[model samples]
Target: MQTSVTFKNIDPSDHLKSYVQDKLNRFDRFLDNPAEASVVLSVEKFRHIAEVNITGDRLKINGREETNDMYSAIDMVMDKLEKQIKKNKEKIRERRGSRGAVKASPMVGFADTLAEEDAEGEIVVTTIDYKPMDAEEAVMQLDLIDDSFLVFTNAKTDEVNVVYRRNDGHYGLIQPIR
Candidate 1:
């Protein structure tokens, strides 16, 4: 792991730098690839803030904590980052299990195996139980959830429709044309 520490509104101290490096080294076992961490330690009046941003293979994590003591702030932020790393690793493991692992077949060439892997990424199928509701009701229901898109049966036409949030901050409705 590579780490860079920055101090803002506080004098740089070797003790603080070494302390953070040691704490970050403890997370090496949780990572598969070399990771770079950027840590910022700042002071605002009586508040001491510590923030760490870690970037590695397929992962980007950030943690920030503020307290009266700089040491405590560093410890708290490291704990938060560790928890997030563990949680993200578990989620990756779960996703891998859901998607069958790729194994090179005995008779298949290396190129063939690569093509198989690419095909696997083409489409993902998931089952969703859509509820029946009107278009207006669907829009209202979508607002109450965090999903980017929702599927609901249009009450008036009894047809399936999708209500989604657009990048332009507008709602889009997808209905099949008869």
Candidate 2:
């Protein structure tokens, strides 16, 4: 992995640079191709902040952490980035591994009940052209769009699926089960 370390509000030190390089080397096992990592270390009053950005193999990951100790901050941020990479890798595997599996579709419909009500309160229905895509692709689409949820046909199972942003800043996938 190629790494660049930048210091802010602190003097540049070779020790810190070597420390970061050694730490980032551990991530090589998770990546198939060479990756570029940009790291920023800063100290503000009592807070020591660390930020990392990694890009490679059609993936970009970022993590930030702040702690009382600079070393601990780097360690924590790296941990966060590692978890994201692992999750993305699993998503890719799941998408490919299920390609040949057959699935049954479930019954789903939206009920439109028109009753006498105030003009101010009304339901607005919008039709969208949902394209067939894998779950990982659906996630990429969700990130590009401002919508909280996306509906698409699963490329592997030929069933409609919903990907939604959860309250915890994670994604949720909804699929029908028979």
* Candidate 2 Cα misplacement greater than 4 A, ranges: 100-178
TM-score of 2: 0.56
Spell out the clash pairs found in candidate 1. none
TM-score of each: 0.56, 0.56
Q: Could you tell me which residue pairs clash in candidate 2? A: none
Local distance difference test, candidate 2: 0.83
Pick out the ten consecutive residues of candidate 1 with the lowest summed lDDT. Answer: 103-112
lDDT of 1 by residue, 1-178 (tens): 9999999999999999999999999999899999999999999999999999999968999999999999999999999999999999878865654565332122211112222333544754445667677777766556544358778788999998899999997999999999
Give candidate 1 misplaced runs (Cα > 4 Å).
Answer: 101-178
Quote model 1's TM-score.
0.56
